[model samples]
Target: MLYSQYLYQDDKPFKTTIRNYNASDFNQLIDIQKECFPPPFPSDLWWTKDQLANHVHIFPDGAICAEVEGELAGSITTLIADNHGEDHTWEEVTDNGSIGTHDPNGNVLYVVDISVRHKYRKTGMGKLLMQSLYHLVVHLQLEAVLGGSRMPGYEKVKNQMSPQKYFEGIITGEHNDPVVSFLMKAGRSPIKLLPNYLDDPESDDFGVLMEWKNPFLEKRKHFF
Candidate 1:
């Protein structure tokens, strides 16, 4: 329920709050998924009221939203997973978007979804949400945060190279995935490449498992 710092528009400053989204946000949250993920991505995959209700009732801290000038701008949902960072499919991990696999005392924070409205893209809303997540990890003393991110641009190069190679290109700076690359800039790194992770035709059903280590935990163990 703690608020993240304020964000400004490129031309003028506007108040943006990053906090736990409630049941009232359910309608807007569904709308954001459509705005962020257009056709070709299954509409059925969008969150339902029952699923969002589980998120709020089960682990409210992990259900985060970004609001600008009292308007819903974006959202990111997570759960403390039981998978132990395995190379699991998105459905298996997130329990079909209900986050039914949530384990409050678990060490890993598993991000199931993140979306920013098209009008709010490139406005730093996504990054601010991530920054709030980092704080959540530290506050809860979790070991790490993880997510299976789609390689949307892979559709173009699926014929040219393997998904692994496409991922390598992204890491090596030779290629950039509009979505995954931005996540890289937010302090996460791709650790594993998963196949058939989701039914994302835009990604050829490919996903890259990304991770952000809890620096607070790291500092407690290392000499650095």
Candidate 2:
């Protein structure tokens, strides 16, 4: 979709548009992944170009990228899942990060990956990516959007706090976790803490399950 309106972050203007992922963006996506997630990066924590291309093949419209002035600023990849009445670890749902388990007919929209280029971060690209997903949720009439958020700055305090306390700290403004804070403001509520969810230690080897309910679903439930 062509996003014409401008959003500013860090006092810089960002004019972005969300579009379906294409074969040409593979290299750029790889670069963004590396930059956003630094060393100690486990192979399973990230998707290779080939794997992402396969995802596009499985569900073309499920993956989206944000472009600013013809440059790929960020991307959000998603898949359909049949997660009902159960909590799933990141690996189980993403098939160890290959996303081979994506089911097109599933009711819940599973967010597989999201990233913003380092230079383009704080430019509101992430929020726009989320808005795009919300739009997809409404258009497709999905139940909700589900994903996991890494506690990026948790390593500094892991020795002194439990994952639960850390999460509460972030929610209560006692700690500043960029990823969690962003997701919280984007309307995704924290479902629970996931232990050993990702191999990357920067996330403190943990992730928080988050969900954004489809407003349409709530409205429909009222009528039924």
Candidate 3:
């Protein structure tokens, strides 16, 4: 569907490709993490070389990225896990970003990290990545796609409403959030609110659990 209109560079539509990233993409990915999450975001939390390598070796299918002119434009890293339908933090579920718990047989495609470089944002890059994920879900016969989304807009209205209420507001159209709203439009729905999900002051340490269920889930079950 995203046939055109990718991130523009110098007022021209830059050629971009979405594909499974390889080891050569390691350094660019690190730079991308720095560009996406700058100071005060805890330098220790950025993507490490070892962790990125682990992703390529452990679950190459889940580690994907967007590229423009041989350079990374953005990326999405994921792992497979059984859906426990419980509350948990990013670090706890993603094995502290190493994704050592990846299981190909798991029913859920758990998104660990999704970052679009500053300039490449709002340009359908993220949307394309998500679309790719949905296709992967169906291909793997998985139940759904799951991710924890930061509520960056929450901090601005924290005094007026609780995090849960704010998330509900996004769901009910009472509020518009950059991250969660985008995910919603991409076919995901909020499952619950996760408190203290990350060290993010902008989100007030709050996050939203989201899911995009596979439409062919029942068909896959019938076949099995």
Candidate 4:
């Protein structure tokens, strides 16, 4: 139900632990979101404390967090979506920015949100969290992991290129948007380029619909 990783730097060991959400993590989640995301994060995207409390209560393992030396460094939240049965945008699944639904039997692991504290951005914490999610996909026997990836560098070239062009550039390595680049390197493929997916200038108000198929899913289903 929980996991941990140890890394060494300067001959010292730092432990990063991944675990399910709890009541006390509410404030830290808020702080991490404020630091990692641009100003005025849509209220619906970041829920109120009471709402998050309810969410964790309903789907305890749906949310996971990473801590380094007992301090919160990153977090990831997921929901089950039946992407194989129908097509739905991030907004529709998230209830127009509010994390309003989670279908446990759905075949897709919908990564509703993921973030790392600003201070730990460049470190490997984010990757560890992602690896944990990948394992989670295997553990749950899901079809794939799906989400809308941000384009942090979009503002710099929004006027110079269209959303599709920008997305292609990133896919082709011509553009170096941090989030999309990271996802691509992690083996996720873009399902489509979404325009105005979120109202963020830093991302040029765009998002890339991304998916990472689970290679073991079919085998697991066959055995089960």
Each candidate's TM vs. the true structure? Answer: 0.94, 0.90, 0.90, 0.88
Best by lDDT: 1
In order, candidate lDDTs are: 0.86, 0.79, 0.84, 0.75
| lDDT digits (tens) for residues 1-224 of candidate 1 | 65746565677666788889999999999989888888899989988899999999989999999987678999999999744565679999889999889987777788999999887777788898888888898999987878899999888888999888999999999888988999999999888788889999989998898888888775532111
**In order, how many clashes per candidate?**
0, 0, 0, 0
Candidate 1 residue spans exceeding 4 A from truth = 218-224
Instruction: Decide which is better by lDDT, 1 or 2.
Output: 1
- Tell me, by TM-score, which candidate is best: 1
- Residue range 1-224, candidate 3, lDDT tens digits: 12223656567777788888888999999999999887656778899999999999999988989888777889999999988457788888899999998887888899998888888776778887888899889888898888899888886799999888898899899999989998888787888888878888878887799988888866532111
Clashing pairs in 3: none
Question: How far off is residue 161 in model 4, in Å?
Answer: 1.0
lDDT of 2 at 220: 33
> Candidate 2, residues 1-224: lDDT per residue as tens digits?
44555878778666777898788988888877877777776744566877788878888878789877878888888888876325457788887666789887877788888898877767677888888889898889988888878888888888898888999888789998879888888788877778877776877778888888788776532111
lDDT for 192 in candidate 2 is 76
Give every collision pair in model 4. none
TM-score, cand. 1: 0.94
Which runs in model 2 stand beyond 4 Å of their true positions? 9-12, 218-224
| Model 3 lDDT, residue 136, Cα | 86
Give the TM-score comparing model 4 with the true structure, all chains together.
0.88
Q: lDDT tens digits, residues 93-143, model 4?
A: 765534567778777888877888876666677777877778888888887
